[model samples]
Target: MKAFILDHYKKKGPLRFGDMSEPEVGDDDVLVQVHAAGLNLLDSKIRDGEFKPILPYRPPFILGHDMAGTVIRVGSNVRRFKLGDEIYARPRDGRIGTFAQLIAVNEADVALKPSNLSMEEAASIPLVALTAWQVLVEAAALKKGQKILIHAGSGGVGSFAIQLAKHLGATVATTTSTANIELVKSLGADVIIDYKKQDFETLLTGYDVVLNSLDGDTLQKSLNILKPGGKLISISGPPDPDFAREQGLNWFLRQLLRLLSLKIRRKARRHRVTYAFLFMRANGDQLSKIATLIEDGIIRPVMDKIFPFAAVNEALAYIETGRSRGKVVVKMR
Candidate 1:
């Protein structure tokens, strides 16, 4: 198997492309012949070691998490799928190398790919779409007619959030630069704010939910536009105490997380709103539901660029520009 890897953490380190042995499957795992892998900011963060404490990866680790491929081998416990099933997953890290031509993942985290999607498009949805689904639908429970704001409206998660919120009958608002206003609108964002030219806080208010993917400053401001009993869900900084507890951080780290979240949470309480930091988990069942949505034409993948397997490092570099309108994909096979 050929893969891109880095042994040391460097912000600008290059991915070394070379040959490596393919992974072995466990009893509950399935081996996949990789077709396409999605690139995300999470990959860059992992490469830089920003998430080392909670989601540590061993040196010589394979960094890819999102993929779409065909099942080539099924372990004894993998009764849900069969050989040659087209599937997708955001595999738990350090288990499978989606950047390689083959991968093995727990059957619990593998879902059948939407039959209507191309391999490249299927690769783009798992991670970001699940993040949107878990945050808006499961965690926040955003209801019909409720107002919500999705920041970076043309990006990976934003594209999914816009459509999903609309699917649930929520009145969706979103922020993007002028160039992507129409793009966001087409994704069902009822109101589109040009982040560069307009202040969203002033342009809209009384939103029931705000999906904050921007900086800390933007997240704080997002709280201010909410009506009483509103909720703010962040995919950026400002970690939740529950998340820290789930990660089993030590006392000092837990305190640090609480301290960081204190002011914003207090402000949210003052306004009768709830605040939470969203960290999406990989679940094959949730991915299966999202796949059905795609097949039903309720949501669609928004791909910005596709790079050959050898150019994965370039794909990672391109997303760091913080201006990609949609997902960047790596064709692995």
Candidate 2:
């Protein structure tokens, strides 16, 4: 099978495309023939050794997190799906390799693809959609009549979050550039702050939740927008002690994470707001609900571009520019 392999971790390095052995399916796994894969900053972070402490992946491994494809075979223990089933998933952490021609995903992490979407569209949903879902629906428990601010509204997780927050009946505010103001508006963002022209902290206030996906400085600024008791959930940087405990890191790493996030966590406490870091995990059930939402037209994919499988490196480069309006996909079939 042809796949892109990462031989070593470097700050700026290219993934080498080469042949690799097919995956071995476990009793609780499903073998999928890859049709498309989604590109995410997490992919780049892993490649650059940024997440080495928590997610230590050895070199010479396939790299990708989101995939949509058909099932070529199912493990004997897999009863929910069978051969020919169209599915999509962000395979469980430590088990991801969707950039290849085929992958074996644990059945618990796979979900039936939304019937209304194409393979490329489906591929774009799992990682970003799941991130949004986990933050708004699961972690924050956002309610109607409340207000929530999602940073980088035109990006992958932000785009989906704005729409989902609106669907949950919350008033949505987001930050994006001038070129993407209308893009986030169409996604149902009630308040759009042009990050280039205006600072979001000055414009948004009394919000119930703030979803931060940027650097530590931006994450700190977000605290000012939320009201007392508001939830600040960050998907990026300075993993908190809670996250380290969730990953079951050793005492040394746990204390390290606590110190890393000490500043933001203390600041959030001073403001009387709750703060925590969110690292999205794979869940077939949550994805199934997302499928229903997509099929119902409540949420639609905001795709930036679809590159051929051979252009995987090019796709990663585009995402690194931080200019893509939405998700970037690689067509493998």
List residue ranges in candidate 2 displaced over 4 A. none
Stretches off by above 4 angstroms in model 1 are: 94-96
Tell me the deviation in Å of residue 256 in model 1. Answer: 2.2
Best by TM-score: 2
lDDT of 2 by residue, 25-132 (tens): 999999999999999999999999999999999989999999999999889899999999999999999998999999999999999999999999999999999999
Give all candidates' CA lDDT scores: 0.89, 0.94
Q: How close to the true structure is residue 256 of candidate 1, measured as C-alpha lDDT? A: 88
Query: How many residue pairs collide in each prediction?
Result: 0, 0
Model 2 scores a C-alpha lDDT of 0.94
lDDT over C-alpha atoms for residue 296 of model 2: 98
Estimate, for each residue in 191-302, the C-alpha lDDT of model 1 and write its tens digit: 9898889999898988899999989899888988999888899998789798899778889889989998998888889889999998888899999999999999999899
Per-residue lDDT, model 1, residue 90, is 94
Model 1: worst 10 consecutive residues (lDDT sum)? 92-101
